[model samples]
Target: MSAPERIPPRSVTTAELLAKGELKVRGQIREASNAVLYCSVSYEGQDAFCVYKPVAGERPLWDFPDGTLAQREVAAYEVSEATGWGLVPPTVLRDGPYGEGMCQLWIESAADSELLALVDDEEPADGWKAIGFAEVGEGRTALLVHADDARLRRLAVLDAVINNADRKGGHLLPEGQDRLYGIDHGVTFNAENKLRTLLWGWAGEPLTGEAVETLTTLRDGLASGGPLATRLAELITAAEVDATRARVDALLASGKHPEPSGEWPAIPWPPV
Candidate 1:
């Protein structure tokens, strides 16, 4: 079976959905700068959050086929599951009146303290308390301070190779005080997308023993006949995976800590 999106309903096209069922607006729960309105979809007493991107004016940053976003996200989560990494739920696709957008699975996430509290004092964050690295002030520089931290750094490296662009402040969570859950990896592993987000601070650095082990496992897992290769291919090109693996191999060989490449301080902001 395909990886379940943890959704209230299975995938469907917007037009078909509207024709067959009625969507009771669950009120605007979230908003992006698009014509899209994220509404809770209802069908036969089932409900899920459906993002409707009305076909209209064009935005510079938004260049994706909206309908496919859900499928791409679904594929990413499936692959991440193979590696035991926690990314977000997949977006569900359906043809709509305006155009094809996505129905995203809801995530019950809180802003991580290690990510949000340190970045903005006014931002009241209630997520992910640091157990060992308690002294770290905020996430802006937490990547620097936690450079040597085992789990945090491992997440950083894993995201880097995956080319995650939206590893935002709220996308990470702590499970049972130890495991780190990373989510919303839709904008990753595309060749043209060199998105640098808040998570790039640890690039060019040496991998920790644990990080190295994880990378190594990822490497072998993406090989021919390997378990995750099929999933990785869906999120990235074969060439892309090859490049990512090469970078990982280089990091392992160096046996040094991370340093910024100084190429670009960051990728474009508000990556669609």
Candidate 2:
């Protein structure tokens, strides 16, 4: 089967697309724990592509309730939009061929971009920042590296705020110049310190002026019972929403990049 075209699926309202889009499953992602499908959605005489993860296909997790992953993906988009970072692509919780699922806008990353790896011997070349190191196996270690891009730095901040438990190497997509977009936010906002990621590069660095301002704005917005909170409440428990609020406060209080607490796994399993 031919792959779906790399189309930018933004433009129309999410609700309108969800109601009108005719979803045709193109293929399944066998690597995902749950049923993940690439699909073509036609709506209002326009065609777009999306990644769909149905609630019924979700594998049960001990920490999270059953069938909440798809909504969590939508919640991540809400937070991303509220912060004005646009780190996450436009996403919506809509019914698809596999039933209710998260439908996200397709992003076509620049072909030249490479998957960053944490290496030990290699000094970070230009455009790469050394984050931290991990034990590979048999006492061998590797240094975690990331692109030295400001947008990605901002995404690191957003990951902390969301308590993202899975910031894999493959999640960061580079597009148009230095733009970075983050995806696969199914395991977020667990009302616990579940921030497993490879973004420890700025572990002790002070927050950039823009990051502080954006975080401050988000905190205030959530406190005022704003649209972000309303949208999150529809997907997650009230406790989890309150936890997200607390996380924002904690980041602001620290005023610097967070260090791994050693309470949970610092990096996600498989890294990518």
Candidate 3:
């Protein structure tokens, strides 16, 4: 089967492509979770941007689908959305010269343009810490800090439920002090073993009234013909999503708050 002829999926959209956009953007290699090469495209009559993980038209060591990572990341974003948590927008996975590939919606570029890796295990040369800053705009000088553990803990629970393996510090974008944006979630919600992350340090801890309320809303709201269903389905498998729903039901039925389980108060590291 001539390797299933490659097809051009939907073109990306950029709000800038409209009569008025911030600036004319050319393809630039910006640093994110991993070294991401990207370009600006018009999306839905808006000046949107897409970041792509380029393949050198060759096979990787894993020898899996060439570009499948991109697709998996898209699924990651879907589950994040279902949680009503602000996360990286969705992208499409297409066939590149070598194998499967991914593309994603771009957030307003940060001043540092660097990632927030706690440690340097799976990153490029300079890493998220070393990348110097460029003034994207006037007031956007400082990098968003993950100083807020409470918020990270909340996100960690969502990551745990979704099984996000790479919820590193760098994947989070600090819009300002209070606002945060999460990205690069390709590794999530798989059928095999779950890679619960650090977002749930407060796990067995009592579920906050707000936390219980949010889980209830998500449980009641998530269904087949829902606004966020398509995105959620894309992020997780049917079995996994159903399992999350079941867990939520059990938690709510028990009327229990959230807390950490086992010896560790949080996920071994932090956040969770």
Residue 67, candidate 1: alpha-carbon lDDT: 27
lDDT of 1: 0.51
Candidates in order have lDDT scores of: 0.51, 0.84, 0.50
What are the per-residue Cα lDDT tens digits for candidate 1 across 43-158?
66555565444334224346443323444454455545545655434444455555554445444444443442233233222433221112344543321122223455656666
TM-scores, all models, native as reference:
0.57, 0.89, 0.56
lDDT of 1 at 159: 61
How high is the lDDT of residue 272 in model 3? 17
**Candidate 2: global Cα-lDDT?**
0.84
Best by lDDT: 2
lDDT of candidate 3 over 37-123, digit per residue (tens):
565554344556566564342234242222345555666665565666655555555433233455566666355633232332332
lDDT by residue (33-70, candidate 2, tens digit) is 88889888888667777788898899888987733898
lDDT for residue 145 in candidate 3, whole number 0-100 = 23
- Between candidates 1 and 2, the one scoring higher on TM-score is 2
Q: What is the TM-score of candidate 1?
A: 0.57
The residue ranges of model 1 lying beyond 4 angstroms of the native Cα positions read: 1-30, 33-72, 87-104, 111-114, 117-151, 173-180, 192-195, 200-205, 255-258, 267-272
Q: After superposition, how far is residue 197 of candidate 3 from its true place, in Å?
A: 2.6
Query: Which of the two candidates, 2 or 3, achieves a greater TM-score against the reference?
Result: 2
